[model samples]
Target: MKRCAALCAGVGMLAVLAGCSGTPEETPVASSPSTIGTTSAPAPAASVPPAGPLGSAAYQAELTKLEQSLAGPLRTLTRVRTAEGLTEAMTTLADSLDAASSQLADLTVTRRLTAVHEVLQDSLGSAAETLSNSDRTEANARCGGVAYTSQKVQRQLRADLSGATVPLDRLGLKFGGTLPDPGPEPKPVRPSNGAIVIRSGPTGTGRLKITNGTANDVAVSIVTDGKPPAKPHVMMYIQAGKAATISRIGGAYHIYFKSGADWSPTRRQFGEDCSFQKFEQAFGRNESWQVNLEPTLGGNAKTTEVEAY
Candidate 1:
């Protein structure tokens, strides 16, 4: 009985092992390849409408009036003065014309007449100033003062003109229709990058050095707090290296430097770089050696007492 029971148990185990073996999973079937080819449509092209007439009858009439107004004066100026003056006069005339032109230029397109007008006006004003001044030096000095102010004015005008022109150009195209060939594209403006360094001279007599580390040439000015010492002379020297020398009897305090042809005051300031109360004379680039600050304050003063180089 025991042998029979053991044999039965082994058969049961075999049956269990056979049940564990299962059927293999079926592989998925893919669909047939499609016969249709890719249908990529071409992109639609931009439709440009044909150009129409340039200006309205009213606009044309106004332009004619401006041309007449400017012509005689411009021609007279051209004949009498140097080329510089002639150029200025012509520019002014062109600007005036542009101002008139802009009124029509926008029939709804881009108009730059206002900008042109402003530039011309400025050029005319500067020219007039130069003509009235006693000498070139005075004229140049006046011109410098006007430069920044005039630039700001022109920019404002340009913005206003642009606002007017865009709508006009469009209106003309949509309604009155047609214009002369579009004016030239605006010239691209390239930005500049650079740095300016101002160094003060030694104690009794000192010099200031300006270095132009930029691609373009720049102008600079030197100023001192309070009246300069008697015989006070402040000189400027420029180029790649070394500060200018100032020869003075007394030391100067609170020295300042201004940058640009416009001479805007810079952050650089000196308190006690040199011990003396003032400098004596203006120095220029011709002198290579920097003025010594040590002697101005007396023997005991530290070199640091002079302005930080």
Candidate 2:
């Protein structure tokens, strides 16, 4: 009876094991452990949209930015005092303008603004070429006067910018008022080599003879040696390699002089390459005073550069 009971129990355990190992189609199969909690696949990355063409306002704003970038460099170029300095400044300006033209070329503009953009780019390129190809000798000659050189460059830049005026105005864009005008050129003086202009002070028997041996024309002024320094008593224009004498009686006074090119009689100064200087020594009353404008080795008189009046 005990053996039959043990055999029946073993058969019952085998039947339960067969039921757990049923066929794939009849069984409810479980997911793998790795994918137990997963619900769906990962999403794809988002893409950026393409930029559209610039409108009128946007195009104008871009042009204004370019102009602002160039203004400072142009002003700096005008302030350079020497020929080499002017050349360097002009090259820098040309480089800046060329870069600006390239930037404009890269911009995408609407159909209406396309023509305007081309005009601006062409103007900038042309101006840059003009400056880069300027004659060095001409640039040096212009360097004689800061004011004269400044005026010339200002006009040139203005003319170049003005080439786009018609197109810019047609589009109702801002133009023509960007660059500041440097003013008109002064009239040239046509006085003789020994012209004299007596300004002020009482007449006297004193004589002043000026010998101008330098390359530039010179104007000499004899001023009273007062507590605050009085106005010049007598003025004379002596051309280069010439001499002039002013005869009159006057008290002790100091001598001041200016030299340069393109003398403007109305303004009483040179239009370019100007310099002002004064003798350190003072001449006494009723005497003959002689001076050589050019500096000489072992000279007795001392001169100092002074500010313009």
TM-score of each candidate structure, all chains considered together: 0.25, 0.56
Question: Per-residue lDDT tens digits of candidate 1, residues 1-309?
Answer: 000111111211110001000112322222222122212221111122113222243333433454455455444442432324533543443444333333332222113233332332333334333333323322222323323223322343334334434544443412111111223422332212223333344334333323333232222233343543221224342322222323331333333222223222331221111121222233332222222221221222121112212
Local error of candidate 1 at residue 17 (angstroms): 95
Instruction: Please write out the lDDT profile of model 2 over residues 92-206, one tens digit for every residue.
Output: 7777777766666566666666666677777877877777777642433342444555566667877887878677877777654556577765556657987885567688777
Task: For candidate 1, report its TM-score.
Answer: 0.25
Prediction 2 global C-alpha lDDT: 0.63
- Model 1 stretches with alpha carbons more than 4 Å out: 1-62, 66-99, 102-143, 147-225, 228-232, 240-242, 261-309
Worst 10 residues of 1 by lDDT: 12-21
The prediction achieving the highest TM-score against the true structure is 2
- lDDT of the structure predicted as candidate 1: 0.29
